[model samples]
Target: MAQQLDNDLQFEDRFHRKFYYLRLSVTDVCNFKCTYCLPDGYKPTEKKKPSFLTLNEIERVTRAFAECGTSKVRITGGEPSLRRDYTDIIRIVAAQPGITKVATTTNGYRMEKNVKEWREAGLTHINVSVDSLDPKMFYQITGENMFHKVMSGIDAAFDAGFEQVKINTVLLKNQNSQELPKFLAWIKTRPIQLRFIELMQTGEMDLLFQKHHVSGVSIRNHLIANGWLLKINGKNDGPAQVFCHPDYMGEIGLIMPYEKDFCQSCNRLRVSAKGKLHLCLFGDHGVELRDLLSADEQRTELISRIQGGLKEKAVSHFLDAGNTGMTPNLASIGG
Candidate 1:
């Protein structure tokens, strides 16, 4: 335990920002054809199907992260629940020492039937993507005609004993932008947190980004004008700036990547589904970590590599300069 505490204190970067959260992508194959992400649906690699990190590899990486001060791990993917051993994955992550919060971000397609099992597997929290509250707009945005089904899945999550379930809505101009009132009303009587993420420009979506990207700043201004109070983030929290209202049962979180000093308070690191370490979401490239994850005895080397890789992390992503890095789309890295 003392050794773990010592290692925990050593995980900070040059800027003194301590990393306590890990975003671990399990796979890159999504089932949704969201307009912003995969308008043409998921396409397999031309050569062959990509091999994702195995459960053993996932365990090794997660244990190393936990030892290095990561207490919260959010399992993501093109759609993480699509994995046959998804629950087992959750259990494995939860069992790792020092890992206190085991969470996942899913599309909620299987929540109605599998949420209870997931909860039993030790999942501490969940975030479901529901782009729009309106059924028609939801279908149009996600390219799936199952908005109501997803909503039902949220209900199932609550019934399964989750205290709060965050709903992710990518702010798209002229798409679901005008539905804030409807969204606020929907969350007024529920414990749901509505997270509005500004549409980011990836390598493959320049034209679409120019046409539809909406600044989360607009929504932040609206919240301030409407009596919502900004809340300070916890030590191990993610990048969202959360707000709360006295009269509402829910809270609002704004993820404005373009905001000044947005990355200054970054407290998380991301690992790709293929076992590569991404310093930033908009980073130029990833440092391969898979070769160091093949054996249990390789954990010491894995930890050393992770610590060395942190030295190369940039001060900021510099998205304002139009640098989107090698990320062709969000699905490729489980964004």
Candidate 2:
């Protein structure tokens, strides 16, 4: 039999897939009802009180993954900033032995109040979802008129000393598509990296895509036509195809999950807020880590489960064929 790898040994597939990145969703509660993510006037389910792995539980899981050679962890949520004890959680995860990088993905609603605290707690980076620069369009997309607040939050994050702050804009056809150039130009004036994402099918947005689909190819062409020189500069594993303008300080990135599939090189695993280990974003089925963690089994089992999940990872996500078996929204998955 193969000698059992040490709990801290990093595992990879035949293609050298380093399973070091862990995306952890800390909660599923959000203050915004983005039209793409949630239906208008949509109410969260009260039946199942939003469940969260307690700080101790999160730390335990983090250590387990770290033992399995996870070097980076990103805290995400419906909006991670909304979680009451989020700062403590960040501090705890950052203090882990093998974990080198800690980051968070937020909607930027409450960032102003918490960015500094998070930075002090040892957060290294942040990614804020800002779909539109227009206040009206922002409200329409998020179902909230907190555009000014989010922008303020971005500034606060910068001031808080976040090393790499990225603004994620989901490109929607006929809605925010026309403003791509303007958005890119505005972000260039700041130190933020602007990432244009191809709207994905998840949660309520899957239905919207059927009606109005926007691909990254179209956005690239639009940028090229507008006289902005675009070039692919980064490696493929980073999700976003990075580009730079000759005259700008900041860079632009296009994430084409639909037009281009990066599953072949996928090296990340997702751990939901409730402790389910997901191998693929489009995967409906996930291994229940909650039960294992609750059980008396030692950390060995936890490491085994994660390694098993990675070994069983699918070759590719069947998203192009319109087959994402997942029902939870991106917020639930910690995009």
Give the clashing pairs for model 1: none
Per-model TM-score on C-alpha atoms = 0.97, 0.90
Candidate 1 C-alpha lDDT tens digits along 1-335: 21257844457877888899999999888999998999989898656878899999999999988888889999998899999999999999999989888999999999999999999999999999999988999999999999988999999999999999999999999999999999999999999899999999998899989999989887899999999999999888888999999999999999989889999998988898999998888999888999998899999889888888888889999998899988888978768
Tens-digit per-residue lDDT, 124-161, candidate 2: 87889999999999998889999999999998998888
Give the candidate number with the greatest lDDT. 1
TM-score of 1: 0.97
Which segments of candidate 2 are over 4 A away from where they belong?
Answer: 1-8, 13-16, 41-48, 222-237, 294-297
Instruction: Note the Cα lDDT for every prediction shown.
Output: 0.91, 0.78
Which candidate ranks first by TM-score, i.e. highest? Answer: 1
The per-prediction tally of clashing pairs is: 0, 0
